[model samples]
Target: MIRFGQLVRVQDGGEYGYAVIGDNQGDYFTENFGAKPAWSPTSKGTVLNPNEVHHRKTVVEDQTITLFIDGQQILSNTMDGLAKGIGAFGFFKDRGMGSVLVDNVKVTKITPERPVDPDNEGVVPVEIKSSDMTVRLDEAFPRVLDYTLTNGKKMQGQPTKIDTIKINNVDIVPEVSLEKVSENSIKYILKAINTENKINADLTILLEVKNNTLEFSVTEIKNNNTSQKTNEEIIRTLEIPNHSLVSVNSSETNANVYGAKISTDTTVNGDTLTEVTDTLRSFNSNYMYAVISNSKLSASMHSNSQYSSGGGANDFVRINPRVKEFESYNSVGLSSSPWIYHRDVMFNEQTLELPEAKVVITEDANDDGVVNWQDGAIAFRDIMYSPVGAESVKDLVAYRIAMNFGSHAQNPFLMTLDGIKKINLHTDTISFTKRLW
Candidate 1:
């Protein structure tokens, strides 16, 4: 079985946040994408920040939920399960702001899976706290969900379904592009593959085509591993040729190395009462990409022992009030790298690890593979999602090494993980294989 995951990242002034890819049962909260704007935390209110995308970034800590925008603590409160296991990090739009981009989201776990090797590849979890967390949660890249936007509009489909834009009857890896069209839209070219075994075409894959979407096939061969066993090898990638299908990009580029991005498009009705997205690259793997717009994302680790909302004695408590609301729009909220990373263990022939049905590599195994609950516990993928903001995007994307992982639900086993490095996309489009990492 192969496990996949990423690191947690904390944004600075850009107003962003994200936890390592894992679970979010204890991690629950909501906020306007970027509405309600106040430079201070609110005990019972929220401010409004006018950004393209507005959503509520709620981090339900063991005892508090602090809202942040542009690295500014706007609102905060105490909650019931504030100090528990954090699972997700993404955006929540009640009805403010408009089309925003959430990007540069990743989740990596430092807390090594129990019984893991002492000398792991990537970083390991130092500790889990609820008050002034001693460990850096920001650098972890933890997430429960992912909403990837190329420029300012939809690049894939919904966060639940990956955009299987096949190029040549093969599954296209992301981060690969076709062309930088008109500087307004960068053609994110994709290629597809077909097979039951490595390079074998045993079935057909379905591709989700949205507005101005196209599907194609691959003409060359460049994949290495068809699957992995340990969590370390689960997220292993197979670089493509010049016509590679996985070379994706963020709306914003840090230095062709690390940063967030949002593809160009006119579908973003953020200026209206609608919020659309294509969380294409969100599931089935440990790696992911997110989009962050003129907004912010954040998270906080409090000490489970003695943590407060900074509101004094009774101020650190949570507020469940019913206030007159306006159009589905609040003010600036908080979140982090909008992403989800999960790990599963299978002695052999895992669910997604092997193959099933649908899009590219789905399947009908001895156990069956469905997304709803009750999918059985046979080493499948974990689900993590979150909201990526300008701040969170700045912390992760382009990191030299990053990864994540999890364990089996019924067995007494643990999975190990490793960090991937030198990952790059072939922006040239003509010869993806020639591109250097």
Candidate 2:
């Protein structure tokens, strides 16, 4: 198929062309006759069989082109800079492939409706409240306007900024929409456009309030531009600015003051110890949770550890938390690398649905009657190990032994007994008698 005013030529000589050929079983190509040929296998061999009447349908919508064979979609390709003029369709057969038949050709034009305008036009802010916390959302740029706990403690600073979304090293400020699912839950739909590369990104953010915790999830990220030939990387970041808390604690990092410390002297070993603050700290690793606290309350951010592994050095999915100064106030937040790894030279299109991360606000996370960094570390351990029951030290030792013995000898208890009896040992003198049991 070729757009109107596009020349149809043989063997990579046309301006625009799309074709499905059965020469090598079955495969399809976009821009078949151009300098860059985008070809993909259907994996269904013999798409066009001899002595058969087949129904083929092709639908073009903006940059997306979909081909359906007998009501089953065979391939869908999205390219950049496709001709928008009237389309022209044609059929062709190779000289040595014998005669071909074409019939019942039909063409239908479709006009898609524009997206509905948001209710508030982004002028007014939307609020979702629960018994323990209240969250305000800015519909203009789709960011948290205010996050306040029930005890009148605010989690954010003034003049909030929009979250960052980068594609191919370019920052994209997306159009935002807010949908209130319930009194305690809301969804944000963001559509970011990269005009330089002609790419569109559809992102979904879901926020829910459960008791004293706020659950935030980047549920879906779709790359609408399915250009297999282009190289792209996406990064989604959520930053909570102007957080006043100076103390930081997590399992992955040491306890330190992220911002300027107040002058509070403490007597340690009969010596006065003055509070100290350090420079900016950045922890880049697979973190399950991090807690920032003050004298009264602590806020803990939890992530799913299973998705945090990068599997190799070249590709990574990490939870990054940085502590820095924003508007002279201490700030801390979480950001993630590319969730989808397209390391192969020729990568396929992907849609990623990520796991949700939870934020808990409390005065004592471990119920230790104090609000401190230890409470935060205890909270992290609880969230990490609660899913699986507690393991004893002996059980852990046995597990380590089994791991060291390799897969063939996995039962540590049996292996230990056998070793004591010299069952598999080469020395016949070191045998244990039956009465030794």
Candidate 3:
């Protein structure tokens, strides 16, 4: 009879464990979860005696086992039992000179239905409705949006493996604005509101691999053909701090060419080093993504060195997940460069109306450039993000000017966007000033 892994999965032989009693008594949950009276491994784990009561319950105290064979290769200690392994079962007879028997070793794997620590599982999905829906692009922003998941257990963590954030049967054209961000959480305000009473949507906040990513070309993969696939790219995903104040600063850095780079700071949470690419993919670019993985020791990493080590509590940061990184390979669009600003802007669905103005208007605020509809609309948007104050108007105007014109304008006013509301855009300075009636 032939045997395959699927065969076992379909018809398992049932659970099997190991148990032995004598001067030393122990138990193995299954052939895969083996244990011995006086054995240990170099790996890390704890040994559970399950109590000195030979076969009563699982408990133990100060009893320690420095199991060794031929007075060498100390298998494990009381502090490392979980890793003693599934193979090799034995008993320590008088003075560790007893008849010890090992067993038929089997293999086992555990599949978790849920993820841990801010994984996608914690934040369930929900469908948005019409009546409850709101959108914020220009003047109005959705302050609240709710959804229900498969399970109602109170979960909290970062979302993972999201299908999509949809609406009206069509996938939502994801447009996002600056949501309420705090020291420990970042709530991205979506552009659309959900009023859907039925169905659930796993709302995914799209985080692009910043342009500051360690660049990799198609050639990086061993079997991947590079010359034929010039357009192929590898976007690196960022690992955000578990608990920290996530904020973006627009201040550009000279770190590398390719324009402005976003510096994401999670200071509120204890984070030693920022970007950490465990292994370099050896990209075909001039610049290499720095790999400063472990935050354990004071030794240098990014410059060049082997892996840093240490585990458990009181350490810097844990190693990133296994099977990750290489698996998150995605093609990046050029326009998706990283941008760190005071507030994020989302895609607008409709033309926005200008906010009421306080400045003396002769209703003659025509398109001389500064007093037109376009400028007014721009001014209004600036005001929304402005801090409430008399000088805020000027800052609004300044921001509007900056937002409208390229950063290289000499005369800020002439370069700023003023005439917005009055007309449809034809050029950078075109606005309808004829509505002076």
Give one clash count per candidate, in the order shown: 154, 0, 37
**What does the lDDT read for residue 177 in candidate 1?**
29
Candidate 1 structure quality by residue, lDDT tens digits, 1-437: 00111111212223223221112212223221111121222232233333533343333443345554445554554433222233444443322334445555433433322222122235322222122111111112111121222332211111111233332224543333233233222223333344342332222222221222222212223333455444433322222111111111222121011111122345632111111122111111001121112211111111101112322222222111111111221111111111111123344333222111111111121243322111211112221122365345544434332222253233222221111212233322221121112
Candidate number with greatest lDDT? 2
TM-score of every candidate: 0.17, 0.47, 0.18
TM-score of candidate 2 against the unseen true structure:
0.47
Model 1 ranges with Cα > 4 A deviation: 1-174, 178-229, 236-345, 353-437
Instruction: Name the lDDT value of residue 267 in candidate 1.
Output: 60
Q: Candidate 2: give its CA RMSD in angstroms.
A: 20.3
lDDT of each: 0.24, 0.50, 0.21
Candidate with the greatest TM-score versus the true structure? 2
User: Which 10 residues in a row give candidate 2 its minimum summed lDDT?
Assistant: 1-10
Name the candidate, 1 or 3, with the larger TM-score value.
Answer: 3
Q: Judge candidate 2 against the unseen true structure and give its global Cα lDDT, from 0 to 1.
A: 0.50
Between candidates 1 and 2, which one is better according to TM-score?
A: 2
